[model samples]
Target: MVELRRSLSLVSTFLILFCTSTTAQPPAPRRSRTRAYIEVSCQITEYPDLCIRSLTAYIHGANATILSPRKLVHYALLASQHRAQHTRAFLLQVSKPLKAKKDQEYQAVKDCLEQIDMSVDQLSMSIKELRQLGREEATPSPSRDDVVWHISNMETWVGSALTDATTCLDEFPGGVRMSRMKATVKAKVLNVAQVTGNALSLFHHFVVRYRVPGSPKKP
Candidate 1:
């Protein structure tokens, strides 16, 4: 009887341990509560599909929790910055083959390159300002003036970046308008400009929805 009771006790202990282990849960991700974060956030953007595509990769995996309204704006800024960098890199490649041509088209391409270089710099500043906004969001009680200042700077810089990209395409010489290289460069620049404009829209959305008085704070 003693041996049987001991055996029963050990089995009960094992069952308890098994149940405890099986029922245990890891912490739920912010994504779980925000299943529609991507959908709702992208819906208001200028390019919904591009916004969705740009942010979907970051919304999964270890970075999944980065989905507050402010973080979404940051993500959009990052996407714009990446697109600017890509467009700049492609322009560099296109410039290489034309460097020694010394034709009107070559000079025009050089002019576009300079404009895109400035666009990249402008986007870089926008990205920096957005990052500063993130830091401000973390403060115990961020100042309204600081938020306005950072966001205002981001708006101006990102708008300038978009204008610069447009100017790059406009500056493409009429001689090269039919060239495949020019078409490719122009398309890429347009992509960067579109995404930057969308990101700026999102920044405005965030400010209106979260930064204003009586706006809802993150849960």
Candidate 2:
């Protein structure tokens, strides 16, 4: 009887400790907040899937906590810049061989290269403006006008870049020899434009959300 009682007491003590330890731990924070950021922010854009895909990189890193509205604007700009750079690289590669031949395709490729170069520059400018916005945010009394102007500039530049991408695609000849190249180039340029367009939409939402006084900020 004594041995059985001792065993029962030990088991009761172990169960109590286990329950206490388990109860002491906090519940894991739901990722729904992070997902809400992607879902809500991407809704304004036509290319929600592309916007979500572009933002996936930032969502997983140590920097994940910085996925606020203002920072999302910065992330979107970076994604646009990255896509623009990739399209520019592709254009540069294809332009080289065609340039040597001086074929009719050379002019098309040359035009695209010029447009892509401009798009890259514009996206770069948008990124710089975002940096400026960050600086302004740290001020004691950041100028709302300054914030508005910078966000507007980002939208304008990104929008222009998207237009340039479309122009590059439209410039390609419908000839059989260039069909494969045209298809490839078109696909690449469209990807850049789609992401840029999505970024522009995100900027618009950021403007609306932050512009209002006493607006509830998202988590």
Candidate 3:
């Protein structure tokens, strides 16, 4: 009887140890939420004409500010292709009430379009000035520092254009137009930030890779 009781006690101890070990083990860490990429391709087809126009205007403005005038012009020329594709899709999917709301939204888009147009003009002037400066032997060539300053200014202008576009769309409520515009703005912002960050990362990597082993300079 004593041996049997001792055996039962041993079994209980083993069971308790097994249960405690199983319960005490920490759960696998929750997976991180993956960031979603904005698909500007097929989705843009579902928006209204006014929304497309607004998006085109903003894209033009961003390109003008972010790229050379030549590139901006190239992008502007491609705008018609996008217009053709999206127009058909929008007309098919867009409702009459949505169209009516789009007419109202047009005012906001028009204002943004005008501002973007003005920005494009300014960008054109800047490009001309930059070209002329480049041509002048007496003006002295722009230093690397000057190049960086110009790039920074361009980024600031692009950011401002994005802000203006967002403000224009903020007046509207739920709809394909508003949703598309919001998504476009967000995608552009994310893209710009990602590009800038990647460029900086590459620069750091290059600096580190080429650095002298004992150099005091930190990338």
Candidate 4:
């Protein structure tokens, strides 16, 4: 009888250990590559020029790519603004315990608000510079080569900003929060991509429309 009881106890111990191990394993990370791609495509089609402008702005402003410093900044600003606008909504959704000690959370939210303000200030400054450069390039009397050089410089600055933004996103730690932020940034970057493509298309169209009919196509 003693031996039998000991055996039963050992079996129970093993079962408990097995159950704990199995339950403790984290759930497999959710893969949403397809959904992400679709979201990116949708965002790209919405406003190509703004997308391009944002991309350029990010490059010139942050030395990053479309998604890195650029998109990250864009979404950060957006999320910050969103937080500010829905202060009451967020407070309502918190658990009772957290709500009871809301001051700490409010401080964090306030910091986020400050970050958004800084991003807006930086973006505004970048846009002003870009507009000035654009106007200079647009002057009717400038030589064709000079205009091209200015445009190329503008493009380079935009591309750099995009690179920076994407890099920042890549450095974020893996988790649900990062994934969600990534999705938001990707969506915004796609918009910038669409805008870039559209601007190029429109520029080409303008060239075609104004070309002297009898002039031979430039080689």
Candidate number achieving the greatest TM-score relative to the actual structure: 2
**Candidates 1 and 4, the one with greater TM-score:** 1
For residue 185, model 2's alpha carbon misses the true position, in angstroms, by 0.5
Query: lDDT at 14 for candidate 4?
Result: 100
| Candidate 4 Cα outliers beyond 4 Å, as residue runs | 1-140, 173-219
Among the numbered candidates, top lDDT falls to 2
lDDT of 4 by residue, 155-207 (tens): 45434433433332343334645334335433443333333333333333323
Model 2 scores a TM of 0.75
Candidate 2 per-residue lDDT over residues 1-219, each given as its tens digit: 999999999999999999999999999987657767787778878998888878877777535643577777778878888888988888888888888888677787788878888999998998898788778777777777777787778778888888887788788645545567768887888888888888878777777766677523332
Ordered by TM-score, highest first, the candidates read 2, 1, 4, 3
User: TM-scores of the models, in the given order?
Assistant: 0.73, 0.75, 0.29, 0.29
Residue 207, model 3: lDDT of 29
The predictions' CA RMSDs to the true structure, in order, are 7.9, 6.0, 14.9, 18.5
Clashing pairs in 2: none
How many pairs of residues collide in model 4? 24
How would the candidate models be sorted by lDDT, starting from the highest?
2, 1, 4, 3
Poorest 10 consecutive residues by lDDT, candidate 1: 210-219
Of the candidates numbered 2 and 4, which has the greater lDDT value?
2
lDDT for each residue of candidate 3 in 94-151, tens digit (9 for 90 to 100) = 3344457776644544554444344344334434433333333234453444444443
